[model samples]
Target: METKREKFYMMNSMLCLLKVVEGKRTTVEMRDEKEVTGVIKHVDGYMNISMEDVVFKSLTGKKKFDKFFVNGKTIRYVHIPDEINMKSAMEAKLKEMCTYTASMRVRQEIKDQAWAKLKQKERRAKAEIKKERK
Candidate 1:
């Protein structure tokens, strides 16, 4: 079971990784220390991002491409712009909190119902054993 704090952090990170940085001129540092700078074209739920007019730089040299697709798993760091609007980000976080809370409640209810059914079966079995003894 994930603690509430863990869930909150996960949600916040998702928002930052997906919604907060879309269409922004950003830099992504790969695990191999190569850096790519471009405008974000698209990002999937998995965090795999597509960028346009991308430039890749390393210790040796730099190369520019018309378009590039990066696997999320290989990404080490994503550098977002400093001038992001916090008001909108807070509003989006509130909305996501509501949605996440509702979904978690539904999951808890399902687990509770399953446990109740299992308990009821155990009681019926015990009752049957007592009846047989009588």
Candidate 2:
């Protein structure tokens, strides 16, 4: 038997980075040219991240915070260490992306079917009313 190879693309790089760097020191650069270094505390599916023991850094100086939450939309870059192994992270990310895609496809299919059924019912109701009027 022959099998075909499928091409997989990274859907959310931030989610992958969050998975690989959780509990590890990370440096996040914002679009405004500010940087924050901390240990990742949590990450949501939206890529919003929370960090513990954060140090906000800029050309001016550095400020410390016990915890911080950064909006995903504001992130410019997330620096990951070269020492961390990427093979496992890539595998996990692929699985996550596949699951998400599958679910979305299923939902869309259900919605299309439901809409078609609704239209059919409306047509039937109109036919019944026309017959009564005759």
> Which model scores highest in lDDT?
1
**Cα lDDT for residue 91, candidate 2:** 78
Q: How close is candidate 2 to the true structure, as a TM-score?
A: 0.58
Please identify model 1 stretches exceeding 4 Å from their true place. 1-12, 85-134
lDDT of 1 by residue, 1-134 (tens): 44566456646565334556778899999999899999998765556789999999999999999899989889998886888765676577557767879998999999999999999999999999999999
In terms of TM-score, the best-performing candidate is: 2
**In model 1, what lDDT does residue 26 have?**
90
lDDT of 2 by residue, 27-132 (tens): 9999889999999977666667899999999889999999999998899988887777677776777687679779978999999999999999999999999999
lDDT of each: 0.80, 0.78
Minimum summed lDDT over a 10-residue window in model 1 is located at 10-19
Q: What does the lDDT come to for candidate 1?
A: 0.80
